[model samples]
Target: MATRLNPYISFAGTARQAMEFYKDVFGGTLNMSTFGDMGAPVDADGIMHAMLETDSGYTIMGADTPPGMEHRAGTDMAVSLSGDDAVQLREYWDKLSASGSVQVPLEQQMWGDTFGSCTDRFGVTWMVNITG
Candidate 1:
């Protein structure tokens, strides 16, 4: 097995929903474990960890903030999706931007590629770039 690095997002209490939304957009298998499942003292239903592995070789992991942990917004981080497949990337952009706020509409950028950004309903930021 090779070492890999992937994004791990933190949510106040919406880890489950955010991970589910990512699965819908990316078409992947989602595995989630909650605090209760692990017999943790935190909210039983709150997600301890959720991982989405996509067919596109994208792995996204996330978790809900445990009880008593502070969740700060605008964390200066964004989950970025970049590839040469315009069609697939656009599909993801559409679904992800549907109910979220678009920071940049998907369009040709000055750098000569299709690029866009948005902050999801869960307050997680995402950037999608499709190479030309």
Candidate 2:
């Protein structure tokens, strides 16, 4: 195994729904553990940890906010997807921006690449860049 860096999101009791939504968007295998699985005296159905590993080699991890933690809903960070695969990237962008707010429409950017940013329905910000 090698070292890796990925996003670990904290949701306000919506980790299950959000991770499921991401699985649909990225077409991945999702493995989730619940609070009850860890013997924690919380909502049995609440996700303690969830991981989505996509065919595109993307790994997304998340969980419901802990029993005594704050979950803020804003873009202090954004997950970036960049590659030369235009079709796949566009497909991802379409699905991600659907039913969500688009901060920037997907189009050619000043940097000479196709770029866009949006907040998914789960309130997670994503930046997609298609390189030529």
Candidate 3:
């Protein structure tokens, strides 16, 4: 089987709620396991891991809040867009990031490609890396 990259999100004690919300939004089959199943006493009720495999061939993995961890919201993630079709992906970035904050404007960078970071209208941070 070919190797694939998937997004693994970390949540602060809300893995089940967050995964369920994602299942509602993306319409996917969610498989979850608890830490207790892994013989973790402190983390027994917490989600050890959860994965959402969507119908559109997207795989997203997430886990619940770790023991005694603090969540620094809005500072820890990036929804990345990476593909060969530079034009199409740029268009998507432009549309999704419009009316939002643009941290790094989309432009040719020193890496010999275009890259940018922006926060969407819904306050989600996104990173678009357009590779040649």
Candidate 4:
């Protein structure tokens, strides 16, 4: 499969509604997954994990609060950048993380790719994925 980049958002408990609203606005197909089915505890079943892929090639991912976790609302969004162009992505990651806090240092991950998370200088959280 080809690689892609998408936005992954976090919600308190309205992920389903939010994703649905996005579907209506963007005109896309919504695929949802409940936490419980994906190895989450029973309490997380109510939270929604969804993805919307529009016909125009837009893709968005999102998930609601996890079990035993408190939702910090406004600080819950993430910009997910992913693709097979490892060199360019790594360069971007290095530049972005140079002056910011590296929450997850860029390194070869178990999934056979380079992945990392960081909070940029502007306070926006970002995740970079470079496929191996």
For residue 84, model 1's alpha carbon misses the true position, in angstroms, by 0.9
Write the residue-wise lDDT of candidate 3 on 19-91 in tens digits.
7865765577999999898898897878989999987677878887678887554477767777667876677
As a whole number from 0 to 100, the lDDT of residue 115 in candidate 3 is 88
Residue-wise C-alpha lDDT for candidate 2, range 3-63, written one tens digit per residue: 9889998888899999999999899799999999999987888999999999989999998
- Positional deviation of residue 115's Cα in model 1 after best superposition, in angstroms: 0.8
Error in Å for residue 111 of model 4: 41
The residue-level lDDT of candidate 2 at 87 comes to: 96
* Clashes within 3 Å, all models in order: 0, 0, 2, 0
How would you encode candidate 4's per-residue C-alpha lDDT over 1-132 as one tens digit per residue?
799877777776778776776576457799998877677657556545788998757797888867677867537577777888787677767766776799998999998988999975545577889888
- Model 1 spans > 4 angstroms off: none
Per-model TM-score on C-alpha atoms: 0.94, 0.96, 0.60, 0.51
Query: What 10-residue stretch in candidate 3 is worst by lDDT?
Result: 119-128
User: In model 3, how large is the Cα lDDT of residue 45?
Assistant: 79
**Pairs that collide, model 3:** 13-65, 36-44
Superior by lDDT: candidate 1 or candidate 4: 1
Worst 10 residues of 2 by lDDT: 67-76
Lowest lDDT sum, 10 consecutive residues, model 4, at 40-49
| lDDT accuracy of residue 101 in candidate 2 | 98
Most TM-score-accurate candidate = 2
Clashing pairs in 2: none
